[model samples]
Target: MIAQLARKIRYIADPAFDTRDGYGGKLVIALRDGTFIERTEPYHWGSPELPISAHDIYDKFEANTAASHLVGNVGKIISMIAALEDVGRVGDIVELCRREQD
Candidate 1:
């Protein structure tokens, strides 16, 4: 099930995510060639159930110098995906994979 979710979110491959660390905070999700799609906490999230938007999550990644060049890539990728949302490929892949999820 996790694998299916991960694959479905592969459109945002290997992007870093912003997370609150004990001391300060950390830019998480580096190794995997995919985006992080975890639910946000109620305290930090506006909706509790669906606080974070896909685009907001993408924006949290740390910019260039160390990791991938995330300076402007976030918006660029989001725009790219937005343009494709009405298309069939992403939906088809997600629907097909979701059928196998258990």
Candidate 2:
């Protein structure tokens, strides 16, 4: 299965793309049907031009942290992070992130 899937996929790097600061340029997808699809994004998503919303951040956090070390503490983490200005001790948040005993 791995070999068959590897044969269907190929990654070709383009030296012309300005990928110095994690910027994504043109992406071309050539399917087996002799058709190609292209997408170009010169700037990163969280950059000035393509700013992300707080909701987007929350969603992404939830997605990435699924079944993580802080499984049941995600809501508390989000709440504390949202009101970070009033959080006097950063260790409180750090404590929540720590995995409990087995």
Candidate 3:
């Protein structure tokens, strides 16, 4: 999948390709075998009735924090936020989010 994504990016980056006016909320892909797939709904899991799971949210949080490397206490932050209802004070979580000195 990663390789395929890289290939697609390369194809898009090619100067010969026409990429103007590419903005769109829908995705339509046409295969070489004369088949195509399309999706019009922008947020599949963003609806209130179909909210994202805690695990999925955590996965996204972890990915963002890891990529940015801006947070030193990710685990503590995740735990604090997960149990925010039981937490005595929100400052405790804020304190844990402080960046560590090198």
Candidate 4:
């Protein structure tokens, strides 16, 4: 999988890359035939142009929490976050993120 990803990926660095325009950084991919493809503005998930689905957010939350070895019911944490608007206190979320004692 790593090899396949490496083969399809390209990276370019520009010393003048800037995001002061609020459009994020630019990405340019130069082709072998001398032409290139470019994106002047970056797409941010959950933004007006590019919106992320709830499932995707939950997937990311699960992946990050698992990788961090956080001790709690991940499903419950996700539920709490999803319903954060109705939550009376923010400390409830903090309690769920506490490390479990061994």
Best by TM-score: 2
lDDT (Cα, tens digit) per residue for candidate 1, span 5-101: 6775433322233343211223344446677545423234434544677656545533322254444344444455667766556754344223233
Q: How close is candidate 4 to the true structure, as a TM-score?
A: 0.56
Tens digit per residue, CA lDDT, model 2, 1-102: 999977887677777666775576777788789999999887788987789998899888888889698768888898999999999899999999888887
Tell me how candidate 4 scores on lDDT. Answer: 0.74
lDDT of each: 0.45, 0.84, 0.67, 0.74
* RMSD (Å) of each candidate, 1 decimal: 16.6, 2.5, 7.3, 4.4
Once fitted onto the true fold, the runs of candidate 1 whose alpha carbons sit more than 4 angstroms away are 1-50, 61-66, 69-73, 86-102
Q: Which prediction has more favorable lDDT, 1 or 4?
A: 4
lDDT of 3 by residue, 1-102 (tens): 999876764222433323342322455577889897976543346456357899889888888889554456788789889999989999988777666668
TM-score of 2: 0.81
After superposition, candidate 3 runs with Cα above 4 Å error: 1-25, 30-35, 42-44, 100-102
What is candidate 4's lDDT per residue for 13-90, written digit by digit as tens? Answer: 654544442335576777889998987655456666778899998998888877665635798888888899988888
Candidate 3 global CA lDDT score: 0.67
Q: Is candidate 2 or candidate 3 better by lDDT?
A: 2
Q: List candidate 2 segments past 4 Å from native.
A: 1-7, 20-22
Give the better candidate number (1 or 3) by TM-score. Answer: 3
Q: Model 2, 32: alpha-carbon shift in Å?
A: 1.4
Lowest summed lDDT over 10 consecutive residues: which window, candidate 2?
15-24
Candidate 3: deviation at residue 84, Å?
1.0
Q: Deviation in angstroms for 27 in model 3? A: 0.5
